[model samples]
Target: MFKPSAEQIIKVMQGKGYSVYDTPAVDWNLNIVGIRANDPEPGTFNDTLAVFQRLQGAWNICYYQITTDPSLHYLTHPVNSSGTAILKEGQYKGAYQLDIHNRGLDSGHLALCQRLKPVTVYRDSNRDNKLNLLEGKTQTGMFNINIHRTCEDYIQRQRFSAGCQVFAEQRQFAEFIRACQASEKAFGNKFTYTLLHERDFQ
Candidate 1:
């Protein structure tokens, strides 16, 4: 339950050689960062997704929410059958653009989609139901790792995320999308997402 301030997050990002969009003129330019919790348990909403921006003259956290890992459920029961895709740690610039997730259907929703460019990921194909971040095969391509929301209610398992960044609550995800829309209007459709491990903070 450790809450990180905007400064702390930025410091970690800088230390890790990640980008920090702190230009004062570019207000509301969203900086999305996902922190993977240190917990070893799979299929759990133990990660955090934070949205930071340079509002006015200061850096601030515009939106923060509890989000599951990009491959939390896939760590156990992978959907790909071939392997589970675990997003690599780093910043992917302009990797996602605003688009309709599950478009033209009842479940369609606003989301940051990875159709703009390719991203690197580790394919855990061992089928051991364990996280093999380093032992997996590295692949780079369009894997449709969208940022969206999960079910409205608090569920036990992370059934929504199959290599996508997923918010745990529906309401919070709406708020996140609103922020993203504002950023889209101010800046552009492309966005950068940075993934970090909890140990990076330590």
Candidate 2:
């Protein structure tokens, strides 16, 4: 149940030489988000996925757990045991949009706006131990990979996330959504999301 902080993860990514696209002119205001799961314990329903953001040369990061399919055993897969394809690593272009009927609250309150863009995921091929720009390519036919929140308020039982990245804490998730919106307003509706290796944090 040990969760690593966003700073630690960012440090690890930097040590690994992954591109930190957080400058002002790289991609419009340099709004970038990073995520990667850490816990590998099977039957661990609420595993932690660290969230990090660099906007306008300032860092706002937090750690939150998430729920994948209840039947999966590995850290990540293209598709879980429930048939939901795991989001592959690489740079993805995304934005915020409201979803009234999304899976979260049973009362159907307005949850955080979900990410509204499909990511062009990059793969680390060649076993070179680096995420280079040349290794990135647009994934065709990969659909429904979103960054959203979970409905469950408590942390004692199994969760209900199909495949999307589901933040367990409501308040933190709301804050994240707000940051995404502000970034969108300032720099258009496109932001960058990078997923690092799960093993790096371990």
Candidate 3:
């Protein structure tokens, strides 16, 4: 029910000094934005991942899914133990491109790869399993936080997202991948991702 219109999103983007590709020539202004909910709980899919685009002077919501925080599960039992990666909110231009996930494996699938560029992320080193985003070190590097799908069935836990923008459902992710593939064919492999907090909806 927290779905936002394209105009609302554009306004928020402009307010934050972020770019909005509204040119008619630009068929797909792909945007991957994360909406952090109020009273967010760790290890739960309380967040939203929205995929929208501007095509032919109109806006379209390609897909949206209930997604978990990038550093939710890792807060308690971090993969690094020293620091948990939490993606900073803002627009990242050309931070991702199309590529295969888990390549050369049986579970390989089409996904947005972030190997082409670097992104800013907060390294939450508390390891206390709490949602304190700003109380961490800010670092910018190529932290392969690719956008990919989770399990084929119901997702009971936040096991897939280890600082990556992940999808909760497989069918929706497939649809999103198709849209990305179409966008890739129309434009190119480059993609811009924007992460937004729920408060930005105002």
Candidate 4:
């Protein structure tokens, strides 16, 4: 498997020229992309790239833990008996909300919803009990594609996610929230999030 360093991920995000989350008094666009490595572990990836860019060419890159089960099959359906889509890989775009009411918790994290073409992984019980992945034309539109923090202090703790991109490190996720909040204050209340597979880069 090809493991990407922080610098490599930034290079890829920078090359894409997507909007960035920067400071105030400047044209800042919040672009957060989660790049999944080719790790075969379930509900976790060996490397995750979280990069935020500023319109003035400034950027911040943070390393976070994503599910190792980086497969479409496990993304929409429950992997094993976890009942979570620990790893969902694809390119997705939707409205980013800075303050959201999720699970009766209101935090600094963000939610990506509203006209979202998100991915879905569900088990086709009638088809011999097999897991299936659907998106785009075959998708029926999914909600709650949130980018939030997790309870895991380390990467190996088996953090749980229901197909959402979770950050195992609380500190890192806090910093991310701060950046997005700053961007929101300067810009509008909506942002853009994109999740790309390792193959999609380069």
Candidate with best lDDT: 1
TM-score on alpha carbons, each prediction: 0.88, 0.56, 0.87, 0.62
Best by TM-score: 1
lDDT, candidate 1, at 3: 53
Off by over 4 Å in 2: 1-19, 24-35, 41-58, 68-82, 94-140, 153-159
lDDT of 1 by residue, 63-130 (tens): 45554354445666777766778778788889999898878877778888999889887777776656
Worst lDDT run of 10 residues, candidate 2, spans 124-133
lDDT of 2 by residue, 82-129 (tens): 233444655554543444435564645443333566654333223221
Better of 1 and 3 by lDDT: 1
Selected candidate, larger TM-score, 2 vs 3: 3
The CA lDDT at 189 in model 1 is 89
Model 4, range 1-202, lDDT digits (tens) per residue? 3445545655665666643344634744555666656434544545564654544554544455554232334334444453333334444444556655255654433543333344543322222222233332132245454676656432343334545566666676677777777767777666666565687555
Task: Give lDDT: candidate 3, residue 77.
Answer: 65
Ranking by lDDT: 1, 3, 4, 2
Model 1: residues with Cα > 4 Å off, grouped in runs: 68-73, 152-158
Q: Which stretches in model 3 have alpha-carbon errors above 4 Å?
A: 71-73, 104-106, 152-154
Least well predicted 10-residue stretch by lDDT in candidate 1: 63-72
